[model samples]
Target: MWRIVAAVVGLYRMVMDATRELFIRILMGILIFLGYVLLSLFIYAIMRRIMVPQKLHTLPVHLQYTPGCSDIQCPFPQAELILNGGKKLLSSGQYYKILLELEIPETNANQEVGVFMVNLTFHSTDGRYLSSSARPVMIRFKSFLLQILYTLFFAVPLLLGLWEQKQVIELVLFESYYEPYGDGALSALVTVQHHGVQLYSTQLSIEANFSGFTYYLYQWPISMSVIVIISIFVSLCTCTVLMWVSDVVRDYDEQRRAALQRRRMIQARTTGQAAQNGLGTQRRGRGRQQVGSNTALPPALEETTGSEISSEETSTVTGVEDLASEMGRGQSTPPPSITPTEGSVTSSDYSAGFNDVLSSLHTLSRELDGQEVGVANRNIRYRTGH
Candidate 1:
């Protein structure tokens, strides 16, 4: 049995889930229906109250026969009713002020009644109450003073059916807790008795009416409340959907931003790499140019060997010194004879001459081979055949 129950419950859940949208649509439809119903009720109530207003119902048999009703006379044993004001009907579910008057016949033909009873039974089948049938709300009392006495002594209304000597029933405020409509009953019964003998009794079908607050304010309370609750529910759902959409948008934006940032970084890195490559190419080209320059002679160098240039430079400097010295001495005596000899040639000159010769040889060797440049730069030393 438990397994069966579980299976049924699971099936029910599956069905509900499958038809969830249908159920929601049905609920929304019900809410709309209720709203429209309320609107119609509101319009009708306003129009009805204004157009053919309900004539306040009062008692006193005062109408050459009230328009929609027949008057009930005293000591009436048979119930009779005549109603004519059918053009207007009182609204349902409201309060009304009722006034009743009773006459004492001074004496009841050989029987004086010590007490009398009046009962007004009310019933209605209008409201959407749990009971589909007409529900009754009957109020009974002897008189206005006796009704108070009953209310005080019984603490609830003379439910014990106690009768006290009294005359007129005062104006009473009646609240129709149940909704009123056609085919409902408003009965009035009066009984006079003394010493266990009934002297007079009257029963009448009285149509009651009154003036007070309108029913549109509180009509179909349950339906209106349901509509309000549904409205709130729909608002909540809308808010939830909006929040979810916002979250989705926020996530998408974050992802797009991150992707854009990554793309920018990648582009920056690629640009930096390209710049570095270009610089390296420039440097390599410069290096090759430098190497090609070294492999050949330059225009700045003369075709005359570096050795010949050095010798010319030395001889010119020696001649300038000799000329300067002879100018300072006597014109007849030539400058002191200067000859190139082992002792006359200064060690500094010999060293310089050696360095110049080595430099010239280095340049010639490089014209042969571009390797071992410093090693090739050495003073020339000629040795005898060994």
Candidate 2:
């Protein structure tokens, strides 16, 4: 019975361990999925809120039903028209050919919807003359999954591109450019005619930016001024950022070159000192053997040299002590080593040399005494001979 109870308890513990691990794995997977989903949602919300509205405002209003609207006399509800709004002439017993364009938003119906009757007419101020003319048009918008994706995809870029859409309208004014009386402003007459009837005729006055003049259309100033301001701001910001980046790169390059020069100087000094001490160590044979047997110098050299050292010779020098221990003691010393003869040093050497040079340069930082370093009268104590 004791044996049976022990086996059952062991099986229960195994099952509990497996269950706990599975639960933890599942939780981790869920968190990763949620992280990606939330990020996508945040991007979508930002584009929809700030970008879409701006694009809609600047989108060109294409007059879909304008050119062939002469035969369209049937009344179509929910149809509207937009014009230059600066015309002023009308005559009796004449019809104006008007163009109308319509845009339909997305609908749930699977089949395409067709356009109905559309027309345009102008009423004179005398309440006696009225002219009307129009044409039949068919406009249809397609629906697909890709269309929805495209709308989302282009929504943000389009918004940013059109964010400063100050040049929203490019009107071809008919003879609407002239300066009058050498004084106030420029004035000209413009006319719009349809079906042999004048729908709009007006005299427009244009004011210059610097001159003391006022004109017919106020919309011109709003659009042009806003666009100019935004363009200037964007240009200034771009130039500023470029200047800042260039300055940073220049400063960084200067510091790097200075550091390199300092490193080379310190390395030359160290090499001179090492050579002068009669300790011109080589990487082989009898001398290494004696040194290894007496001290742990070989491994320490390997560690220090390996941190910044390169080349086959450097590595061999590092392994010299280890090799010496392998050899029998009391062997004769090896030949002298030489510096590298050719090719530029590696980036690794620069990094290594940086550390060594920095340490040496800052050595005086730890000094507690206030003695002048280079004074002729000072007791310039030298370090002990290596």
Best-fitting candidate, scored by TM-score: 1
C-alpha RMSD of each candidate structure in angstroms? 25.2, 30.1
Steric clashes per prediction: 8, 14
TM-score against truth, every candidate: 0.26, 0.19
lDDT of 2 by residue, 209-245 (tens): 2212122112355564445445554555567689999
lDDT of 1 by residue, 68-156 (tens): 33234433222222222343234444334333344222233323334434333333333222211111212232445755565577653
Mark the regions of model 1 whose C-alpha exceeds 4 Å error after superposition.
1-217, 291-386
lDDT of all predictions: 0.41, 0.37
Candidate 2: which stretches are off by over 4 Å? Answer: 1-219, 279-386
